[model samples]
Target: MISAPMLDHIVYAVPDLERGVNDIERQVRVRPVSGGTHAGGLTHNALLSLGAGSYLEIIAPVPGSEAPTGALPFGLETLTEPRLVTWAVAVDDIERRIEAARLAGYDPGERMAGGRDLPDGSRLTWQLAVRAEPAGDGIVPFLIHWLSEPHPSGTAPEGCQFVALRAEHPKPESVLRVLRALAVELDVNEGAAPRLIATLETPSGRVELS
Candidate 1:
């Protein structure tokens, strides 16, 4: 059996990266840490530090975009508005994990290297596997492999820590089962309604559901 790994990051898809980051900062009261661009010029990402090698990621496409090189994969093509698209979990070996996913009946595609530019102009690169289908209401996490040296979140900004993460659905246990089947490691449970909730600790106070 495949064992789930640590919670890596959660992704939110927005129409615009700059605007999305600003909006989230306004709500959370902290500027999200920057993550660099992706391969297809789909610029993105702000990192919310969650203690213990985990974090929340908010992603958006760059404005005035060019057409992406390949066919749009699962969540990217279907997303109509800014919302939580998918979460990612870390693995010791991305290649091995991809094989495991394939054996378990998920056709995770080839590994792709992508990058994002930081606000300060520095760039960071990472790897990911795009799935053929949306993982059912964004509850299922896509796989990610961080290729950059030392991993992103190694030196997280001060005043941030991941407290707990929760996912809510009418069939909460079912959702957990899917996540488990995908080998994602986290403690997930039902919420008040059919929604996913993530809790964070910041300098200001505790924040929930980003």
Candidate 2:
């Protein structure tokens, strides 16, 4: 038997935030609201409520802002179009999850702290396990611990819910192993290249984002 973690949020990397907002609004019939800025000031995001427990995050570099070290997650530093990028799962015991990944032969990276300020001036603080290397081509999700902060999905733009979230890869079984370590599941198919696919129910009917 395999365990699956509860989803927290999914990321959509875009080149221009305003343009990304326009595109998402067109597809879902609702606009994403500004989600505040990263501590590094290199990136800012807008968000949409996908359901009760999860939301969609569209992140892009802050125009002329500089990233601290390497490229931003999901390739946002040089993103041309909006991409599904990656997802996050909520966890109560992040250290345990990281150890599980290590035992499974995958370094889930270190648990780090980060936060963003909401529009009303309230701050949201959380910790997450970032990957040491770009594994699974952004298909594998990072692990997040939101502490006691109110989840963004509750107050984000609503009217959408995920119908399906799946992926394809050359080695489905190997990828499945990593997902198992993270305690998350996604429908995986054998394909030439790695890809993430998600289906959503929106005001404009069903929309697919990947």
Whose TM-score is greatest here? Answer: 2
lDDT of 2 by residue, 1-210 (tens): 112236678788889999999999999999999999884777889999888588889888888877667677567777777788887888889899999889878888899997997778888999989875656887888989986567899889889986778888999898888887776778788999988887889999999898
What lDDT does the true structure give each of the candidates? Answer: 0.64, 0.83
Instruction: State every prediction's TM-score relative to the real structure.
Output: 0.76, 0.92
lDDT of 2 at 57: 93
- Find the 10 residues in a row with the least total lDDT in model 2: 1-10
RMSD of 1: 4.0
Per-residue CA lDDT of candidate 1, range 1-210, in tens? 112136777677776667777876776677777676664565556676666777667776555554456333324544566676667776667788888877876656688776666666766677777665645466667777776755566654545676665565666677666665666655555566545566667766887653
Q: How much lDDT does candidate 1 score?
A: 0.64
Clashes of 2: 1
| Candidate 1 TM-score versus the reference | 0.76
Cα RMSD (angstroms) for every candidate in the order listed: 4.0, 2.3
Best lDDT goes to which candidate?
A: 2
* Total backbone collisions for each predicted model: 8, 1
